[model samples]
Target: MASTGERDGTGGTDGAETAAGTAAAPAERKASWRLVGPGIVVAATGVGAGDLVATLVAGSRFGYTLLWAAVVGCLVKIALAEATGRWHLATGRTIFDGWRSLGAWTTAYFAVYVTVWGFVYGAAAMSSSALPLVALFPGALGLKTWAILCGLAGLAFVWFNRYAVVEKIMMVFVGVMFVVVLYVAVRVTPHLGDAVTGLLPVLPDGSLLYTLGLVGGVGGTITMAAYGYWVNAKGWTDSGWMRMMRLDNRVAYLTTGVFVVAMLIVGAELLHAAGTAIGSGDQGLLDLGRILEERFGAVTAKLFLIGFLAASFSSLVGVWHGVSLLFADFVERTRAARAQGTGGEPPVLEVARGQRERSWPFRGYLLWLTFPPMGLLWLDQPFGLVIAYGVLGAFFMPFLAGTLLWLLNSGRTPRQWRNGPLSNVMLAAAGLLFVVLCVQQVRELPW
Candidate 1:
């Protein structure tokens, strides 16, 4: 995939020595269509079992009325991911670096946020992945045992592998899960007419707050911020790759849209029609599995469980690699800022260019994500920490959206690459939407 730089005859050495948080542009080559990646990584990482459950619940309560919301959610994420990749390629900086450049406040919040969020999330991810395994094996191992094993496997896989290996595995897992969900959606024999109408914007009675979560709250988690890091890891560090990045970003969310739509269809046809209720989280998928077994037989149920495993494990490994990469970049940017503060030179070594996977920060965060959260699996998550995590996690999307708006519009970005009118509108809308969700979530949290 030749970048725009290569095509335009201005390739700027492929992000060789770009600094962490500087306003620099690494010359790029024009993007080739066939070499798209990173999107899969973001997509796989974004659509965890929790997300699927949310979509399923939306379907169960309202049928296809909120299908439009699912599609809009995909569009919102597409804009966010595109802006993220654009910031990285247009200005040769990592997302963490961009956030740092805005001020110390961004970094401080992120430090606390990632630390708390990762500890809680690691436990959640492991347990989510472990759910299917326990169901399929029928008591071969306890939930905590399976959860620990899942966490360790993800840690090991990401610890030794590079971005290329990670992307390929993500593609395979996402691909399999998509097919599985699509098959189930088909098997359920959805109300085709209702689904078509669902494409139109319409909200059912009393589905406001609950539906609003799906309506505007679709941009997954920190993985969206990690999109840029993954882009650099793909070796597309200049504006030349902008076209490919946009296309790749679109493909990512479209795949996500299809996945969730299929789940909604299953919930609408299989569960909603009979007024069936399922658990609201990972156990939700297990409930669906039980229903599938009772209705369709063991084979179908097992297949769905396998799909659940794939979806969960892909997220586990993706976070292990992607977020660790982000944290590594964070450490690099922080150290560089400190050096500059002390009248020393901050390092010019950019992420993804110097084998960042081998870096200490990356490995440290990986272990931090893997081993530290195991305790939460054995015991109840502390109420105070959970509340803190809830608040931080809720506010992160808005923080990211607001900062992207600031960084992309300011002098930090080149004149030619600055946010256009459409970009501004979309980003502003995203920021406001996230703020509303944040307020709602905080209000609901058990403070």
Candidate 2:
């Protein structure tokens, strides 16, 4: 594949540097399609079942009124992902290492967040992924059994495979789910005027919170922090790949934007037009499938359910793998005495030690995500645990945005590859929005 600067014609400073750096490298002249990997897979995996349900709920409730918020969500994610990939490409450091540079506070925050978040998120993700499957194949394996099985399966997949293999699997599911969901939207034949109107920025009555939620939600999640890991895993080290990393980030989120817009179209045209109400949980999706069957046909409903399962399952795999790596990085860093003492560990520590190469934390977290969560699938998730999860989860996006802006623009990165004016502005806007959402979440929490 050609470097991003050559393809896009945007020869920024970083682009020129990358071009110069790769000047001596062999030019294989491979097709661009062959270069598709981690970025697209990560983007697809990041938009899990919750994102889809949230978008559908927004559409069902507000029609296309919040379409701009969804678009904003996509743009914010692009900025975040680009920063992450750029950090890895420019500094040859993962996000975990980048965070450590800011201060011990960042590492401390992540240590606590990843442990608790992983526990609660494991059960939630498994249960959500299992819902559509259970609906389609009731009593085949029981809900909890299926959830545990799904988690284990994901663990196994990520444990044995390298980045390229994982990317291929994710891409297949992305293709399947995208086609299925987009086809459903096309079948709805939505209103062009209302969708166009949604593209404009307007806040309707009693929709302040919902609008904010849509803007902040869309495809935002902890996996946004995992982009650096994906970039590293794709062999995109050094400043030479910075331009490609940015392009990868942009393309990933652009695809995500289209996927989300299509879903909003379905919600606006199908459920909103009929005045139908979806339920409050994953089962609500099954309810949607039934509605689709009644209105359109059984095939349509089955296809939709299949797409839902694919989305949820792909996210299950992603969280099981991506978050586990984050957890491993956190553990390895925090346990290092130098890291604890200095308020930041050396990036060379991560590169040289390669603790993840032979670490139990990596596999242990994977097992934790697969097996322990099954109990929660059987029993109710504790309210206290849920509250903690909510609070910590709410803080991650803002934390990520804030740190990216601080690090990328600071002396830690090469000045030539640091955040330009546009990137800084976008990151600032994302940080502000996420801060507002975090505050709203904290205030509304049941303390």
Candidate 3:
């Protein structure tokens, strides 16, 4: 692939000079078809075991009635990830850099949010990943032991590897996830006629909140913003890679749709048809595994459990690497400004160097995500912390959507790359949808 500056005819920003007085390196070229890894990583990360269980529960409750919501959710995420990639390529800036340009308040919100979010998320991810492992090898380790081990393993893998290695490993796990979920989907004996009819946008009676949840929660989170960082990590730093990046983003959500819809199929065909209800949370998956074992034998249940581990573990390491890269960039630019005694923006190249996966801040956050959260695994998660996590998490999607609206439509973006009417409409829809969801989440939180 040719660099963005070379292909798009837009040169780098004039003042983006490194401390050594060199211009930022131009974006490089690559085949758009071949640039598929970053999206895979994002997709795999976003749809962890929670997403699957949620889809399963939806299917069990409403029996394929909300299948359309899953598709819409993927479309919403596609729009968000595409706009993020466009901003990166068109402006040759990191998402943080753009957020910082918005104001110091943006930085402040992100700093506190990331720190608190990572603390809670790391333990949750490890335990989720360890669930299937313990199920498959029950006598081998306890849940807390397996969770701690999973956390350490993720930290080690991310700390030792770069973006390329991380992408490759995520893809392998995604393969396992696809095969097992798809196999169960095919075996579920779906009602083809009802599924076809579900393509229509009908909200079943009394299913408004559940339908909205499915539509808004399909395959998104802060990991959506991490897509741009992954694009840069893959060395696709210019408008030249925009087409490929969009394609990759679409592929990510498409894969996510498949994972989600397959779980829906399992829920509808197995649980709904049998009048069985699974419990909530990751344990719901364990409940499903037991049912699968009784019906299809131990081999099938083991395979699904293995797939579950792959899905959760992919999120663990992906977040370990992707979010850490974001944090490291923040540290690098902040310290660079302080050291220069000028509050001016740090050069793009300066932030680029800090992208090294082995950087100190990267490893520090990795350790933070790995070790501290283990406390929550042993002692129950504190009530206040869970409430705070929910509050911060609720606003993040809107924060991303509203900020993208500002960044993409403003002078910050190139004229050719600004959001078209359709993009704006979709983003506006996403912003509104998430705002409602955020309010509901806040109200539902037991303060």
Error of 1 at 54 (Å): 0.6
Write model 3 residue lDDT over 1-447, tens digit each, in one string: 223221111122323321212334345455566669899998898888888888998899889889998889889989998998888877766777778767778888999899999999999999998999999998999999999999999998988778889899999999999999999888777888988777788888887787778878867878888888888888777776777888898888898888988998999999988999988889999999999999999999999999999989999988998888788877866665556564553433434432457789989999999999999998888899989899999999999999999888876676667899999999999999999999999999988
Those runs of model 2 whose alpha carbons end farther than 4 Å from true positions after fitting are 1-33, 335-347, 350-358
lDDT of 1: 0.83
Q: Per-residue lDDT for 1-447 in model 1, tens only? A: 122111111112222322222445445666665787899889888888988888888888889988888887888888889999988877666777667666678889999999999999999999999999999998699999999999999999998888889999998998889889998999899888999999998878888775667756543789999998888888776777888899899988899889988988998999889899999789999999999999999988999999999999999998999899888877876776665564534445433353678999999999999998999987899999989999999999999889888877776666677789988988898898889889999999987
Q: Which TM-score value belongs to model 1?
A: 0.92
The CA lDDT at 102 in model 1 is 64
Per-model lDDT: 0.83, 0.77, 0.83
Error of 1 at 231 (Å): 0.6
Can you give the TM-score per candidate against the true fold?
0.92, 0.89, 0.92
- Give the Å shift of residue 303 in candidate 1: 0.9
Which regions of candidate 1 deviate over 4 angstroms? 1-33, 342-347, 351-354
